[model samples]
Target: MPRKAPSITHKRSRASKPKVTTGCLTCKVRRIKCDESKPHCNRCLRTGRNCDGYAPPLPRPTAITTQPTSTIAHLPSLSAVLISLPGTPSERHSFHFFLSHTAPQLRGLFESPFWSQHVLQACLREEAIWHAAVALGAVHGRFYAEGGEGGERQMWEGEGFAIKQYVKAISCLTRRGGGERRIDVALMACVLFTCFESLRGHHAPALVHLDNGVNLLLELQSLEKPRNLITQTYPPTPYTPLSALQALLTRLDTQATQLLPSRHTRLHPVSTPPTHYETFISLEEAQRASDELWNYCLYTLQPSYPSPYLHPQPQPSHDDLAHRQASYATALTTYLTTKPPRTAREQQAGHMLRLHTLVATLSLSTTSLPASEDVWDTHTPSFAAIVDLARRIIDLDTDVDIYAPETGRVGLDTGVLGPLYLTALRCRDPMVRREAVELLKKERRREGLWDSTLLAIVAERAVGIEEGGCKSELDTGRISDVDVVFDPEGCRAGVRFLLEGGRGSVEGHRGLVLTTDLPRGQNTY
Candidate 1:
């Protein structure tokens, strides 16, 4: 188990006694003082024992080490990375669960290398990341365990351990302070914390933490683009781990934009967004294009800064939004033609990208008429297409419940749920909307800011009141603009909407606002 230190040389005592340097690892373990023998240790040579010739212990790292700072910066922070491993048996188990189970869920369908690789690599070098990872793993297990199976005592105990780990992760980050690149470490921690809160059904706090990370990202290279926050959105380069982290955060930021109207100064754009791409030569290229275009499209909706202030981006003038829409759609169309799918996963990922493109296009058509709730009715065919795409995505996913157990309940980024939720709430057609509702009902998972089960209830109830009236399931009226406010705990949400015919005035929900709990099922949470 003893490894050679590359940077630190053998030391000598105050009395001028030289530290043991050349010796067999076996002799060193036996505490035999060496004669500083050359070629091979005399004792081991005489014993005819197999020797693991400890090549002069590799020198250990130090301030004086010749490695460049940039190179060193890329290495995991040793203060935490190599500081500690999970010590207790329970800690070990939870950390393993995080690696094998929870981490995979964080990846969603795209299998992001950030979750699967960079995070785990960070876990080794950073105590903060390790603690957070353990905490997340424990929370994931606690949430997904078979209902009434773990019992109250076991559940509470698991939660306590997770909380303890979460605190430790925080403490580790605090102790680190504003050391070099600490903000980057904090951004990664914010992501983990956001996921932890979301899985507990606490979306408000999840958004808060998610927003914290987003704010950090905006300021990350702000000096480079002093005025434009969106320009600082992504790394100028790729392949590095931070680039992957930035991509993940960009995707999450877009998720936040959809949930709440941001309050920040919307700067007028002078530069055009990245809309032109030749073709995808690699899977990485395809994903990068998808994420960039997706973010760009949604940014047009919520032109928010990292600051907290009322910023409304109602619609684009001069036909700007429509122009951007056509440009993005054209790029994606070119992708499908040039880079054909070789694997089933690639095909499904392609489907996911197209769904977002369609949703963005749909939003562009109606942003100009923000006051008209019925404007969505004009896009029923678009809604139907969205629903059909979602069905195919779910059917083709390798981790669907039919193929993988309990994989349906969690995701760290956007998925089919968002598009389906949009369709279910906006589309007036009963058949199309209900199909969206059914798909969401079956989806017990929480996809970042969107909880499918909770939204399914809202969509279904909206459909009911719009048509079902206060007493019956059959009617011709429609419901518009379901505004949902999720409780910080995520188990319950307040829903308010307008009824076209005002026929459901006397239902359980007084006026239009109603409070509802998350539906109960096999894996309700």
Candidate 2:
């Protein structure tokens, strides 16, 4: 019965439906198909007008309905509405006021010294300190601030995120090789020390941190290669080289020694306790303090920042100059207190001479002066003391080699060697100039370190000599000798001098050359 009823069912077909055809303009207006034929379309041609192919109008969602007819009836034109908008008018008028008043205030906070101090002192918690250190380490200056209530708010939030990142990195580093047990504690210590120092001002506590870091580095007994200290506990990441940390600590210690003389007046002992407000009272005491500081610094450098693979080769240990100076100062005090030498006068003279020599050497070693006008104000006092000590050493023993490699190059005593070339150039001393030439000549023979500035300085100083006369006109390929070399960018600096008819020529060689017009023979030569 079912089959009989199905006998009346419809037959199946496989053909597809045909697409509709319409003129371009009509299709477009009606939001439908266009036949896309050339020449005039049927509709347009019939109407005796140009025909354009169909373009569908954009569809509006059904959800968006037009405003009520009554509301639209009273509506103004777009232009009128825009002109009357309250916020738009106010924004246009306050544009300059916003730029002038607001932008500078924001920029000023960024550059303010107080802001940095506040960040360092007020926000330095474990997490904040860690993140700030990472930010510094990563050199990511852009992550400094983001959206927040104020500059300080941004600083706190950004730094907080950065700290979290830092702690993760630290954990990663510790777990790198296998686990925390395999972590490079020395490297960690150094990283920790650096963070503490950066957060806190350079203080004795900072030194202690550095010392502890070094000790931790020394504790890493394993000498493994490609060992991931952080991966031992967490996951893999990057780490700064341990040597770099050691170098940083060394530099910091050196800076501290340089700063101490100004910070503490009782640096050296004097017979009369020289009433000069700036006089250092006891060099011996200063030396002890300096030695203690140096020991602490060195102690921090060890195991705290160990070599990644094999243990570092041992190097000769040099005593801190400040410590040595303190010792000599104490000896001077003892000598000054001694009764006038009568019996065994030769022995007393010899002892006094030895003491003087020691004091001179100590002074030379402890001082480091700036050689340029730019840093003169900052470095003058420290350098002046060092220079004075160097001069005194040279006076006491003319034969002494201040920079002798065998004697542990103590100070900038130039003597026959010439004042330290950098110092000589800075001080503009002739003796130092001659010494620099000799040193340069030696360096050239040994290391090929000659440069244009060095040559220029030499040429400038050699003006009086017949062969090396200061002609101002440099020969082709002639190198300029000076304290510092000029970069190509800086070489253009002579343009003003050239334009003003200075002694040097600027017409030839495509605007390069500061020299006299040479004779044909000299030019050829």
Candidate 3:
């Protein structure tokens, strides 16, 4: 009956079950089924809830693309650019390729308004436009040598171009700011001088550049004083930049005419004597210029990285060449002969003296000598001169000794003196040997000589003399029936006899004898 009723009723099919739905938190809060779409579901929008989309994690950035900010990155690249441009076209090409790629990055930095402004602000605050100028110079130099395939000639050209660009860029950077920086200009001038010096066949130009640079540096130096330039504001005043420009100009004026000797003077200085004076002046100026630059690098610029051009200078050794040897000898002789320098700077005079002594010893060892049985005959005068110098130095020590507490130790130790005496003994000349022996004995007497090694040498010489025996003193008195006495310890007996007996008479057995009847110890012969 129930089934017949349902069929007959034609009643609407049981209402379809409502679809089950779940919502995200945002949708649920609004009491709505969420499409659960990431970021913003419809339910979240209806409820006015914030629906943050699912954020996939961002991948880490790669390293190669990282940009450089300061001078550190530029220096190595600059050095690479310079060194690579010196050999072959291949090298030049490679360098060019590197520069071409890197230039864009540099250009990017240069074109950046933000970076430019920052640089300007930095230049104003620190007066360090030199850094910027140097960088610019490097860039320009690379750009200038734009052409060249890999070849040695190309490499040279590339290098030359780089140098030129460096000079020009520095010049530009340091130039008075028509909105430009001034310290950069001065630094550029200085760098130009340096470049000139480093380049072969460019000494004359280098001098010109140096003079210009010096003038600028001097002007800048004057401006560094607080009284000359005021700097107590937010963005520092423009005094430094202006001063730097002035400095560059001044150095340019001074260095241009003074770099090298003229061709005429190099061949015949007497004929063109004025050239000699000019050359000397030039050398002095160059030295002064170098010193000034070094000071600037140390004090003013205070570079974070060492200069690329600065290489470890190789020290000259004694055996470098014949010319070197002669030069060393001349220098030593000159220093030794000259009056001692007085200032704190010349405090190295003591060291110089030591060096001279070492040179003299080396000279003795190396100097050729003619064959001679006598050591003095070989090199008597030279040895005497050396000894004299040594004595003079020793005397200085003694002079210092009087004020020991104030002056500290005086003179070298006995260790040195002992060797000097041994050197004297090695002399072939008997007179020289005697003199050396006397000196050794004198040193022993003065220094309270206690070294065992020194004592052993003395002992050996004394033993040799005793074993060899010495000529006997001739006896003038006449005697009869002379009896000759010989003993193994005759040397000792002779010494004892000389000291004890005041008067004695004797005759040699082989020589003529005076015969007389006389008793032993009683008769007078």
Total clashing pairs for each candidate:
16, 51, 33
Q: Residue by residue across 203-286, what tens digits does model 3's lDDT show?
A: 334444554555444433333356434233211433224333333333233222111111100100001101111111222232
lDDT, candidate 3, equals: 0.31
Better of 1 and 2 by lDDT: 1
* Poorly placed runs, candidate 1 (over 4 Å): 1-85, 147-157, 178-181, 221-242, 261-272, 303-318, 399-409, 472-479, 498-524
Per residue, candidate 1 scores C-alpha lDDT tens digits across 118-173 of: 67666655678778888887877776543223242263344778879889988987
Tell me the whole-model lDDT of each prediction, alpha carbons only: 0.60, 0.30, 0.31
All candidates: TM-score: 0.70, 0.23, 0.23
Give, for candidate 2, the lowest lDDT window spanning 10 residues.
Answer: 516-525
* TM-score quality measure for candidate 3: 0.23
Residue-level lDDT for 190 in candidate 2: 45
In terms of TM-score, the best-performing candidate is: 1
For candidate 1, the TM-score is 0.70
How far residue 472's Cα lies from its native spot in candidate 2, in Å, is 60
TM-score of 2: 0.23
